[model samples]
Target chain A: MKLFTKYNRINLSVMAVVFVLSGIAYYLLISNLFIHELDESLNDYKDKLHVFIKQHNELPRFEFFEDIVVTYEPVNVALKKKFVLVSRFNAEEQKESTYRQLTFTEKIGDTYYAFNIAKPVEGTKTLTKTIAATTLVLLLAIVSGSVVLNRIILKKLWKPFYTTLEELGHFKLSRGYVPVFATAGIEEFSFLNRTLSGVMREANNDYRILKEFTENAAHELQTPLAIIRSKLDLVIQEEGLTDSQGLALKSAYTSINRLAKLNQSLLLLTKIENRQFAAVQAIDLEAALKEKLVQFEDFWNAKGITVTADLTATALKANTELVDILLNNMLANAALHTQQGGSVMIRLCPGMLRISNTAVSGSLDNTRLFHRFYKKAAHSQSNGLGLSIIKQICDVQGIGITYRFESGFHHFDLQWPV
Target chain B: MKLLIIEDEKDLSDSIRQYLALEQYTCEVAYEFESALDKICLNEYACIILDITLPNGSGLEILKELKRQGKEDGVLIVSARNSPDDKIVGLNLGADDYLSKPFHLPELGARVAAIIRRKSFSGQNQIVIDHLTLDIRDKTLKNNEEAVPLTRKEYELLLYFVSNKNRVVTKEAIVTHLWGDDVDMADNYDFIYSHIKNLRRKLAEAGCPEYIKAVYGMGYKFSIPS
Candidate 1:
């Protein structure tokens, strides 16, 4: 449940318990006060009767009434003046009624006589009922009103927090767009916003510095390698070189070329991880695959490998250049791994693309296949980065890539949401 | 033809100067930004070879200055940073071509020659190599005024060999020149041998002179009969 609802429920429950307990206490106190007031009035009426009897020197004639009654009895039955509540039947009303009675001994002529005075107490009960009902209605109104008012106030207070949270969700370090946090009126929420903005700023700065270092390292490394390659080009043109020298130069040349390729691949992988290429659009994947296949037709034909394509139209949102690179690397890998006269197969379906080729050797080690520089064997023709690049692309696009060996052919399958 | 080399690396600039020296083009070297800018202000050349990164300032500044002065000299950007942003920006600033680093020297020579041709030879679209004449605009080859049919790859190969006419072109150089950063260097060079064979056969069928010769185990050399 929401915090506001929880707080309101607890608050109202406590108030309800207190209100009920106080209502019972109030009923007892008010009823006792009414009974005390009735006793005082009965005592005053008895005193007035004594004063009248003294003035007349005879027993006062008594009158019968509906709510009050005066009666005389023998002196031995009543010892002293006292008040008691009793229920009596009244001939006029024909029902039992509660009343306060005062009894006292008074001299009439020669023998002692007991006098009784009674008054009905029905108004006290009505007064208490009205008071209890009024208190309950007022309590209910206060509890519900405050709960609603609290909810509205809290929602307004938390508006800035929600805004900051939403902006933080959309922030990307690679894009270098920092979120602008709105000022929360409350102290703690504003402090939280400031701390988060500072943290993100530091993180973004670190990421940019690291990215520049990578690009600079790749650039710096290429210049010297180029100089070496150019000098080697001149050395190879010299007159009369021994076979060993030529072999040495050729080995160095090949190693330098491999180094350059490795650098470029590493740079490209870093850029992909950092999201340097963020522009994406809906592209026809089947058409892109066909174009790549055309580019590789000659390479495969030169190796006597046959390409079989089963294309079903597929479109996905992705960076076009990355898609081109992805397809090129995959096809090149397929061509490179297959033996002479081997066949390559490509299939495309809705939300999926599958490429399979005949492998000259047994199944490759699945664990190390996509690791950087994890070649199948030492001195293999591949730079060992093609599969790694594919893995990175799949991760960025939220695509799934699976590898399997079935029917003596190695298969790579890629699937994504349409 | 005249060219200015505005690269920060001395050894690379020296090698470029030496390679282009064989093409009979006058070459000047500027090792820093100030000197490169000075050279641009003082002289007019067929093309300017620019390096984006320099010690004193950026090579892009030289390109900007060249444009600001309205110098129509062809600019070919050579950068170690093979970023698309730089390529796009350079091309937008009127640079004719972009070549990534560690490129083969012969490939560089071919690009410079093509740039010079595009800039200097306005309506002259044909390159005459003895009896073998190549129509650059149509991408066709003609010998003794008779059309010789060639595939796209064959035509490109012919242009590369002709660009470095008599130089000994290695299989690695030919592959790098034709396939620009695409083909794996460790793979077999048989593709180059096949392409060269096709081009030679087509030339011979057209009654052209035997200009392309295989130099033992080295590579092929294209030249007039001696």
Candidate 2:
């Protein structure tokens, strides 16, 4: 439910209950007042009859008054005056009408007489009925009018709040698109915009600083590494005396090479996370994959491994460099892990791409396959960031990547959106 | 050939100077921005190895100054930054080449030679190295006035060796120089060894003297006896 509807629903329901109860009370009070007035008039008429009888020592004629009835009856005992509501027959209209009647006993001489006076009161029922109907119409009119008014006026009143919400929804840190919130006339909305803009500016500043730190660290780390590599190059070229020294230098050189690669891979991961490469275009994925495989032909050929590809002509939209890196890392991982004389197979269809290779071991640790610096025990060639790079690419591109080992073959499946 | 090394790092500049000295290039060093500017204003060197980040100022300002003075010295940017924006900016400011940090010395020597050759306008397209003549413009090798068939990688490898001739080029350096930074050195030496063997055999079949000699337990040296 919308905020406006939810709040107004409760308000209107409470108002409806109160109006109904008050209407009922008003109807009862007004009807009782009308009946009480009729009773008072009838009592006054009885008193006049008693005065007339005392003056003339006889009862007055009943034909003299209209809508007022006076009746007399002989009784052995005297009774006090009392009023009651009774239905009486109308002689002129020839129908029954409700009236308030008063009865009492008055003694003129030795014989005792009972006198009755009555008055018609049909307007009270009509009055109560009209008031009840008007109350119902008034309640209904108020509810519907407020509903329409809320739909228009509340929408206008909350316009700034909705606009601010929309601006926040589209904000992106990577693109550095901060919203310029307009000044809201309402105090609360203006306060909200001011606070949110401050938070966004701070966030953007922190992000920029962090990104620069990563890039600077990479650059600083590379210079010393360059010196070490150059010195090692010079050392290994000198005239060697023994076998042990050559082996030690070779091992140290290998470690340095690995360190440089590790640094580069880590920097590349940071760049990917920072969204440094954002240019995108349509690319022939099959041709790109084929070119990468051809580039790796020599490495696989040295190990006597064969490659079989079944790539359909398909194009995708992505950053060209990212796609190339993704493919190169996948192919390198496959070639490095496969046994000698093993075969590598690639299958690409409309919505899927699969690369399966013959594994030297039974199965890889699936839990840690895509984690950084996670490698199989027997594989020393990989710096262990290949699959992690692949995972990051898939995440950035909104693709799906999975690994499965089945039927003596290790399979990697990449599913592209259809 | 004469060159100037405009860099902030002492050890890296010294190593570069030492390595290029073996190739018979005279070197001058400027470790700060002011010295670099002074040397460029006073001297006319064949090439200048410029680092983007110097002690006093940015190397880009120096590049702009060189262009303003109408100096024809070939500028090669050697920096630790690997961003495309830096490379693009340097190239737009008239740099001859851009090489990132931790580069192989042989590769550096090759780039320096190519830059010098291209900038000097020596009016010679062919480089004759003791009966193995390399047509630099056409990318072909001719031994004893006869053409020798070579693959792209083998040709590139031979040219690299010829550029840094008489120096011991390590196998690791060869891998890094031929294949790029992406290939691991320890994992692909067999491929390098095979390519070397194939290159040697092809040159021998062409009846050329042995130019590439394998130094025992070290690397390969490409030179003919004096």
Candidate 3:
């Protein structure tokens, strides 16, 4: 749930409870004041009656006034003076009405008489009801007003926070970009922005340093490797070398070559990760594949591996060098792994390419296939970086690649971006 | 022919000098940028083997200076920085060719030879070895005044052999030279042997003397049987 909605729910509920309790308390207080005033008038009326009886020295005539009713009863014993509330049927309105009654006993010329004075409370009750209805209407108006106001104001307040979240969602370490967060006026939001900026800056710095280290390490090894290779090339030319000695030299040469290729491959992977090849161009997929196949024709022919190609005209927009490496690695992988006298099939459509070669072994470990230095055969001469290079190229180019085993063939499917 | 070697690494420069010495080329060594600049300003050479990274300055500066001087010397850039940008920049700055470091020595020798041939001969380039003649321009082979048909790879292999004649060339070098280093056919020595066998048969059928010799487990050597 949104923060605004949650806050509004809690705020409005608490406001409603307070408003309702206050409204009931207010009605009770107002109605009690009205009843106290009516009781005061009733006592005043009794005092007036007593005064008149004393002044005249006889029973005064009973008269009805406003909503007050006065009555007298001669009793053998005097009754105590008190106030009582009673419900009585009214002849004028024909309905039950509440009244406040005052009763007392008085002796006039040796005869004790009981006097009762009562007043209807219908007006006070009606006033309290009207007040309560008005309070309820006011409470609803305040609650709805606060809800709308909080939604608009809180949305504006959290604008910077949401913007920061969106920017972080698109952050990429390989791009080496550190976003500059806008300064938020709110204290907590500003603090959050400052902290995130620092973290992103540090991450980008660390990434750049690591990439530079990889590139430098690869480059530094090249000169020595070249020197060793050249020295070996000259050493093997010496006359009168024994067969065993020549073989040892050849093995050392092969290892050095492998080392060189491994170093170069690592460097290339780093470059691709860094997005160093940024130049993009339109490439004719059919022409490029056909050209690469012709280059590999001699190798396939020597191994007696037949190739079949079903191609359509397809074009892709990507870095030229990366595309070339991608194609080279894919084709080389197919040729190297296919058994002698086996067949390799290539099919290309508008946005997909599939290459399937006769399986030399069972299905490979799909999870570890594209990992660096993942070799299917333990003693294979390949540096085991071909598939990794192909994978890296596809990832950087936004192409989808998958491997599968079917019909005794290892199939690699590539989905091109539209 | 004279060539200049501008490289910071002394061991590599010495090895290059030793290998090229067998080809009867006089090589001058410059271990730093100042000496390289001084040498280029003072003399003319058939080619200059330049390294991109030097002690005092970049070898690209030397290439730019050479172009500014308008000298006809061929330049072959050999750098360990295999980045495509460096290669493009070097070639764009008028360097004749760019060869990344850790390259096979025979490949280096071939590139240098091709640059020198292109610069000196001005398109009329040919290599005549006894009864065999190679037309570099047309990429054809002639055995005793009769044209011998050669496939593209076979012709390139022959040219590479003739460039570093009498020197043992590893099968690894030949494979990388023909199919490039990216092909990863290191275990396919049989393929190399077969291709060499075909070239030998074709040359032998043309009544040429046997020139290519397999050097006991090391590699192959193409030389006049002496």
Q: Answer with 1 or 2, whichever has the higher DockQ.
A: 2
User: lDDT of each structure?
Assistant: 0.84, 0.84, 0.89
Off by over 4 Å in 2: A53-65, A68-129, A241-255, A262-290, A299-418, B41-46, B64-72, B117-149, B161-179, B182-226
Residue A135, model 3, lDDT: 79
DockQ of each: 0.37, 0.40, 0.66
Q: lDDT value for candidate 3?
A: 0.89
Residue by residue across A32-92, what tens digits does model 1's lDDT show? 8888988888887878888887788677766654346888776654367888889997667
Chain B superposition TM-score per model: 0.95, 0.94, 0.97
lDDT of 2: 0.84
lDDT of 3 by residue, B1-226 (tens): 9999999899999999999989999999999999999999999999999999999899999999999999888999998888889999999999999999898888889999998888888857788888788998889999888999999888999999999898999998888888888646535767777789999999999988889989966589989876
- Of the two candidates 2 and 3, the one with more favorable lDDT, higher being better, is 3
Query: In candidate 2, residue B55 scores what lDDT?
Result: 85
What docking grade applies to model 1?
acceptable
Ranking by DockQ: 3, 2, 1
Instruction: Please provide, for model 1 over B1-226, each residue's C-alpha lDDT reduced to its tens digit, 9 standing for 90 to 100.
Output: 8899999899999999988887788999999999999999999989899999998898888999999999999989999877778898999988999998978888888898899999988899989878788999999988888999999989998899899877767777787776646434225667567778998999888888888887535567777897
Better of 2 and 3 by DockQ: 3
Off by over 4 Å in 3: A34-65, A69-92, A97-120, A123-136, A273-275, A298-308, A334-345, A354-418, B123-125, B183-194, B201-210, B215-218
Best by DockQ: 3
TM-score of each prediction: 0.69, 0.77, 0.86
Clashing pairs in 3: none
Error of 3 at A377 (Å): 7.3
